[model samples]
Target: MLKLDDANIEAICGQAAQLPSPSLPEVAVIGRSNVGKSSLLNAVLGKRGLLRVSQEPGRTREVIFIRVGTRGYVVDLPGYGFARVPLSVKHAWGRLVEAYLARRARGVMLLLLDIRREEPSPGDMQMVDWFRHYERRFSVVLTKADQIPRGRWKSASDGIARALGLDKDNPPFIVSVKSKEGIDSIRRLLTQGLMAE
Candidate 1:
């Protein structure tokens, strides 16, 4: 029953200094390119055009700040790997992401991985390591859940957790934007702060 139609983006910034004062709690969506970050954001907002869906990977070049009903913020970051951009630009994305992850206070990171993927990518692993090292509160979300059969969801979630070195009890959230499964759970986690998963 959670509704995100009230979501609105307050600011968009690439540099840490340009970020807004962050008057509300924040949740960030991050992952490799083409991982459905945009789709998930659009679904959460209950609007399709809120986030531009691009076929090209690495299209989001800056950090986008989407404010939700005067309550909190949902930040969407640029994807990490295999963007058809110059080396300099790629490094810039890294710096922007690193700075945000390290400095954002009272923020929970939603680390997204495709449910269809069994093995965590190198970039995904590195991100998890960074989160652990910084003691940041984060949860993994396995997107594209509809790609796999419903009966296999548990096995897939467990496999992904093991691959990421997370305890079996700490499996990533399995969600499918198409089927509307697990969307409410994500909403609660975002607005309520780490509810029982």
Candidate 2:
């Protein structure tokens, strides 16, 4: 089991050039703006108020790299879609994210989706396509699971997976920051990635 108690922010990069050199495996968290990426991360790392959570979307304008234990990192990519920022700024974010992803062949991505949303947005589809195009390792994680009834989880996850062109039987990870559900599973996944040699 990989320990996350020692995890700490390692770097905040606004551009690809500033990204830390790849030394260990990374688990990259990604999602649309206001999808609860920060909250999920905080829960997984067992640290409250570690990653700044903002009511306003698009507050995370840069890629944040966090060192986890002595073996790996957890990367926070800027959220896409539904941000109130200018078009130019969004474009810049897209470019920077693209650059970072293009270079991280060894990294695994956790693509988050709001559990309440019935359909995957255009931005979500684009991200899925990008990951497939590059043959990168990625997993879908449904956030805010506590907002919906527990009985609806199965159906909701299946619906989202179908929308994203993924297997319904193997639905995405259903998570809730409030309930701390599925946080340990995500942590285990990241731990496995880090432990792999």
Candidate 3:
């Protein structure tokens, strides 16, 4: 797998059903609001400010599709946890996201989690369970790893691993957008060449 020809990337749509016909492979980025999902995505695409980053949580209110290179897309899904919206809005968001997750045949999910948090939220755990039940392809990414001291990165990752029942030695991809640590590995995974593999 090689890096994407990111220069050709373009947004498909802000809504799921409105996505351009599945002309390419699709990868979805999902996590709690403010988990730095957008930041991580920018790093992966080598495009700062391409996707909207907001100080406000839940600012991303739609399913955004970005065509990457010539064969695939990087999907930016609206954040789930702690969006601070009304219950009705949240439920609506759930329905919207569910449609995409359950129906997108070429979709893979990149589940992001905050590394500094004590444990995965109940909602996050439930999503994992759902993925297992449906046999969905997904990957975990621990975001904001730079917040903790470099010496304690492993301990922090291991703690999260233990809490989430992940392999302590093979914890989720831990990364820090601020420091650009662990971004290359993710970029490789996201690159068009690797997606073909």
Tell me, by TM-score, which candidate is best.
2
Q: Could you give candidate 3's per-residue lDDT for residues 23-43 as a string of tens digits?
A: 567777888898998888888
Q: Per-residue lDDT tens digits of candidate 1, residues 1-197?
A: 43568887678887767866645677889998888898998887788888877878887778998877756778898898874689998788878888887774576889999888878899999899988887777889999888989999888888878888886565688888899999888877776642212
Best by lDDT: 2
Each candidate: what lDDT? 0.81, 0.87, 0.74
Which regions of candidate 1 deviate over 4 angstroms? 1-3, 194-197
Ranking by lDDT: 2, 1, 3
Query: Candidate 2, 48: how far from true, in Å?
Result: 0.7
The C-alpha RMSD in Å for every predicted model, in order, reads 2.6, 1.3, 2.5
Clashing residue pairs in candidate 3 are 1-193, 1-194
Q: Model 2: runs farther than 4 Å from truth?
A: 168-170
Total clashes for model 2: 0
- Model 3 segments more than 4 A misplaced: 5-16, 19-23, 167-170, 192-197
**Superposed Cα deviation of residue 42, candidate 1 (Å):** 1.2
